[model samples]
Target: MTEAEFIAALRRMPLHPGAHGLMDDSAVIDAGPLVVTTDTLVEGVHFLPQDPPGDVAWKLVATNLSDLAAKGALVEGVLLNYPLGDSAWDHAFLDGLSLALARFDARLIGGDTVSLRGPRVLTLTAFGREAAAPVRSGARAGDALWVTGTIGDAGLGLAIAMGGTGPEALRDAYRRPQPRLTEGRALAPVVHAMMDVSDGLLIDAARMAQASGLAVTIDLDAVRLSPAARALGGEDRAARLAAATAGDDYELLFALPPDVTPPVAATRVGRFDAGAGLSLFDTAGPIPLPPRLGFEHAAPR
Candidate 1:
């Protein structure tokens, strides 16, 4: 069967509470008082075989946890959907996951297991509590654009892993990406809208602006880069990697009113203008946007 057809099989299963449909990773359920979120990651798509299983498990769990973080949800627990390979592989993966869960007091409730003929896939459903979680489309036109942590490190880290002249210190960027959970939780309460930067910063910025019905203008000179990222491109070439092709940063991107100060080391790289569409401004001027796009899934590694 085709991939799409294979996915359609889950539709035959009986639905339960919180299940949006058989197709969703997250379900809407009442946890006494809040909403929740869940996300999943596949083997080849989310991580490389060369990457350690420990890191793979962490990424799988943390990526979903980041979603809850964006919504100001206090993490209650996580349900792991682990597709086993060998017993040893599964045990080691869980060992790594145990460390992360313990760090946040998140217990693994329960999930099903299945054997796969192909590569490994990890799915996680993270539940949290909040009276009102941050929604993606709540920003106003004058909301300030901000992000926690520096951009481009993870992108350059991937380049290094793929033999693109990046340093070892930066290599941890690909091996271990930190989900800005605390930052997201803090920002959600005050900001208009918030999201974690899994894709390239410029692209995610554009998405936030678009979802909130405003234009985003990023100042190329204003972006903060890790020393490792700066060393990779050399001199002043951040404009080359600032927004395009970078992925897995896992930091929060948010919007706040003009008068508010960011709680973290947030940079004002852009603004929500009165119009629609994103404008990337470098010293030379605004770079023309690519038609109908940003970093899409499987657009050539």
Candidate 2:
């Protein structure tokens, strides 16, 4: 089954009201401002097998926290599901986990561990608090689309990790992504909808538009690229498209009224309209949609 099929199947199972039909990334429980989210990373899939254990641990924690950030929730604590591995790797992972938790001001409440088997798999569940959590489906037509921080740094970082030449900053970006918790909190009350860009920006934005029953048009020239990314990839239409489709950005993508200024620094890349699908344009006028929008999981046969 494909990812969509799997999700559709899961939707048939018993679900709580907080599940939001599993349409959103995080669950907003009615039990006193609580929000919860979980994420899993496979060694070969999410991270390179040769990557440092410490960075892997940090990535695991950050990915989950990114979900909470999209919900504009405050990080309270996390539960880790770790696999016991070699003493050296285990020790390094714990060290990285310690630093990540401390940096995020989150504590490790509890979790279960198991013996390492096959490819290493790690999971983290984060709990947070927010009175009025925003969902991706809340976006509306005429809302101006916004995104936090620069895009595509992590994509270049991934290339560096895979042995391509690049700056350490890019590599660090792919290894240790910083979740936009502060930005999310500040934008929560003002934005119509929001979500972290884990998958490619185009795909996530398309999701927001689909969920809200609207159409979105992204201005390729408007998609911001970091200095490093621009220096390496240039500012051509191809480069901008690459950045927009590269995943693991971990930045918040939100929708706000065109007249309102965002409290935090963000780039306005697109807008929603009363239509059905995503559209693309640049300084050169309309562009055809790319064949592939973003990274997606393929089910094993």
Candidate 3:
């Protein structure tokens, strides 16, 4: 089943009210002012089999933290689920995990480790305290869509890691992702809706729109591409389109009033409307939607 279908099935199952019916990126526990999110990375599914253990560990933490960031939550700590590897690889993973946690000023509270028989799978459960109410859903018609950081850097970086030549910056972007925690904290009081762009820009935008019960129109030309992505993707409209559809960009995508500027560096890529779906536009006019919006597991056959 597709992820959406899996979630749909979950909606019918018994769950805590704090679960938000599994509709959000993270669960909001009612007992405490805490937000929690968990993410899993398999050896081949999320990362290349030969990827550095340190880099993989860093990404595992970063992705989970990104979810907490979206909730306008302050980093508390993390619980790790580690599968035992060889001594050297395990040591490198711990070093990387330590670096990431220290860089974010978050602690590793505790977790479990086990011996796996097949491919390695790493999991991290991040806990955060709600600084604000946690901006989950509030977007409205006429809200301007904004995104932080340049798009497609990590996508191009993945290409580089797969033997496609590119600048080190692009590779670094993919290897070491930066979760915009500070920016999320700053934007919590301002944005109408906010989410991290873990999928693709277009796909994530569509999700926010759907959550808000509105239509979002994205201007292809308005997206900001990193210098590294532009250099490798070429200087053309198609390159920009490719970047928008490429997943794994952990930037922030938010919506605000048309006239208000975000405190963080961001680009206005689109605007929400009183409709029910998404529309894509280029320099000329409306364009056809791409076949695949972003990464999805177990696509319908």
Candidate 4:
């Protein structure tokens, strides 16, 4: 089954109210003021086999925390599910996990380990606390779509990781993505809707539109790009399109009223309207949606 199909099937089973219909990034359970999220990374898929073990561990933790960030929650702790591997690689991963936990102000409370049977797979579950959390479905008509930080650097970075030449900053962007925790906490109170740009700006924005029952139009020219990205990929229409569809950017995407200034730095890339789908435009005119909006898991045949 496709990922979507699998999720749809899961929805048929009993679900906790906090699951948010299995739609949002994290599950917010009110009992403990808890916000929970989990993410999994697989070898030769989420990360290259040759990638540093420490970097892989960092990514596993950071990606899960990014979900908490989107919920505007403070880090409480994490539980890791690890597979036993080469002793050297295991030691390196633990070292990286220590650094990541310290950097994020999160504690490694507990977890389980198992023998590796095939490709390495790592999972992390993060717990956080916040009185209130925002949901992606809160976007309303006339809300301005905003995003934190730059886009597409990681996409270019991935290319460099695979032997293509580019700046070290881009390589780091791919290897170590920073979760916008502070930005999420600050924006949660003011933004109508919020989510991290994990999959891609275009696809995630489209999802927000679909969730909120509104339409969105993104101005390609308005999408932000870092100097490194522009220097390597150029700032033309193609570059902007590539950036919009490139996933792994963990920056927050939010919707706010046009008149209100965001408490944090953000780029206004689009606006929500009264209709129901995603539209794209540039200085020239409307552009067709790309065949693939972002990264999606394909089921084994």
TM-score of each: 0.83, 0.88, 0.87, 0.88
Residues 219-299 of candidate 2 have per-residue lDDT tens digits of: 989999999999988889998888898988999999998888999999999999998789999989999999878876511
Q: Each candidate: what lDDT?
A: 0.70, 0.84, 0.80, 0.84
Model 1: residues with Cα > 4 Å off, grouped in runs: 1-30, 163-165, 238-244, 290-293, 298-301
Q: What is the lDDT of residue 49 in candidate 2?
A: 94
Clashing residue pairs in candidate 2 are none
- Report model 3's TM-score to 2 decimal places: 0.87
Query: Model 2: residues >4 Å from true position, as ranges?
Result: 1-31, 298-301
**lDDT against true structure, model 1:** 0.70
RMSDs, each prediction?
Answer: 7.2, 9.1, 9.3, 9.2
Taking the tens digit of each residue's C-alpha lDDT, what string does model 1 give over 1-301? 3333323433333333455544465554557775556666767677876777777877776777777778877777666676757656655676677667766666554455666888887777777776247776777887788888787777777767766676877767776777777777777888888887877777778778888888888776777877666666653644354434477877788888989998876888778878888887678787666553345662121
Query: What is the C-alpha lDDT profile of model 4 across 1-301, one tens digit per residue?
Result: 2345434533443444566666766554554768888888899989999889889988898888888888888887776777877768876776777778778887654555677689998888888887258999999899999999999999998999999999999988888899988988898888899988888899899989999999999999999999999999999999999999988899999999989999999999999999998999999999999997777661111
Off by over 4 Å in 3: 1-32, 133-136, 298-301
Q: Give candidate 3's error at residue 249 in angstroms.
A: 1.1
Q: lDDT per residue, candidate 3, 176-287, as tens digits?
A: 9999999988987788889888878888899889989999999988999877787688747778777887777888899999989999888999999998888998878888
Weakest 10 consecutive residues, lDDT, candidate 3? 1-10
